[model samples]
Target: MRLNLQTDYALRTLMMLATHGGQLAVDDIADAYGISRHHLMKVAGRLAELGYVVARRGRGGGLSLARPAEEINVGSVVRDIETLDGFVECFDAGSNGCPVAGVCGLQGALSLAVGDFLARLDRYALTDLIPSRQLFAERLAPTSPSTSPP
Candidate 1:
């Protein structure tokens, strides 16, 4: 099961914010991760819209998690970013071109696997993955930063 780049970036962005706790500029996040500020801004906007993070403007303004790390479920974040739950070609409603689309056990099995994956994620919060925010920051600090959109 592979997550798309958008989802991957969303997760990374969330992890970064989760670790920061305090306010962080979008530029700092992009720079820290060596990712495109434009893409990260889009991700940040989605996160803000979903109530996962909040954004503020001004000299000290930046972004931060809306809730405590312990309250934010990792599974919920992934679900918000993931457009489809389909694991196999037959599972997609738009393109079920497989010859055995209607009678395939593969589709059912894959669905089960995807469900299990999400279920496991549901059991964890961002804090569960990283014990210390400082540690997380230290681990991610080596990456380059990018310029965020104003």
Candidate 2:
């Protein structure tokens, strides 16, 4: 059950906001993860639309978690941001082309596996991902030229 890049970026953005506990510019998040600002922007937009994050535009504008970190369930976030329909061909009943779709036990097994995967994630929250906020912040902090390796 692999999450697409969009879902990956969405989770990363949420985790950063959860750790920062304050509004952060999209560019800052992108720079921290060495990801494309454009791609992050799209993910941020989707997150904002989903009511996970508050996006403010204009000067001093930034993104911030819409609710408390502990209230944001990891599974819920993934379900909201991820398109699981394409996980397996049979998962999408309308587009399923498998000849043995009805008789194949693999689809049912895969379904259970995906359910278990999400169930495990349901046990965690955004805050759980950042066990040490201080350490996370420190790691994400920009490095000065003096601290940069040759």
Candidate 3:
């Protein structure tokens, strides 16, 4: 069960936003993670559309979390970012071409596993993973005063 890079970038972007106190330019986020600005832009756009972030254009404009990190559920984020509809052929009733679509336990087991994975995520919010915004900033932000050398 691997998550696509899109989801990974989404998480990273959210984490970056949560730690930084102010609006962050898309280029800054791309540079921070050494990812493509073009790709990051797409991710940022989707996040903004989902209401996880708010984006502004022009000078002094960028991205910021729409709500507090504590209010954003990791499970909901995963659910929004990942496609979980077809864990196994049986899960997708419309196009399931498997011969034993209803007779096998494989689909059921996989479904349960996928459900449990998401269920566990429901127990935590983004803040749960990054409790100290300052600490996250200090370690990950290249422009952090603490990370700079004398």
Candidate 4:
């Protein structure tokens, strides 16, 4: 199952924050990932609302992870951030027009696949995904806003 652009951007934003481990502006994250600012702003806002990232507004203020990387589970993030529904045509009865919706094993199999995928994701955290804090720190540049923080 392909994750939506929002989910992808959310993950990218989280990973970038994890790497920098410092205050980063939304623009910095968008530029770092080469994603749209409008979309990233939504992702960052949702992340802050969800307590994944702490957002501050003032001088020298920006965004940073609310907790340590090791504490933030990747799977939980995906599950919480993603709109997990309609893996297949038969998954949603409202839009499902499949003739064999009830009997077809495809839906059940795909469900299992999605479950397995999520389960595996739950086993990993931001730290686990990074593998090396040193490498991340070295690669990620710290964000320095020229003007007062928004």
- The TM-score leader among the candidates is 2
Candidate 2 matches the true fold with a TM-score of 0.96
Candidate 1 at 134: error in angstroms? 2.7
Which model, 3 or 4, shows the larger TM-score? 3
What's the CA error at residue 56 for candidate 3, in Å? Answer: 0.6
Across residues 29-140, which tens digit of lDDT does each residue of candidate 4 receive? 8776667999988888899989999998777777899999889998889887887776677878899999888887898888889899999999998878778768776555
Best by lDDT: 2
Worst 10 residues of 3 by lDDT: 138-147
Show the colliding residue pairs in model 1. 31-144, 31-145, 31-146
Candidate lDDT (C-alpha), each: 0.83, 0.93, 0.88, 0.84
Tens-digit lDDT string for candidate 1 (1-150): 678777888888778888877888989888888889999888888889999888898899889989888899989988988875465668787977888787768877778888889999999998887877787888777544564324
* lDDT of each residue in 1-150, candidate 3, tens digit only: 898788899998899988886799999899888899999999889999899999999999999999999899999999998889966667889998999878888988998899999999999988888877788787676775875788
Indicate the worst ten consecutive residues by lDDT in candidate 2. Answer: 81-90
* Residue 2 displacement (Å), model 3: 1.2
What's the lDDT for candidate 4?
0.84
Query: What is the alpha-carbon lDDT for the whole of candidate 1?
Result: 0.83
**Clashing residue pairs in candidate 2 (N, C-alpha, C atoms within 3 angstroms):** none
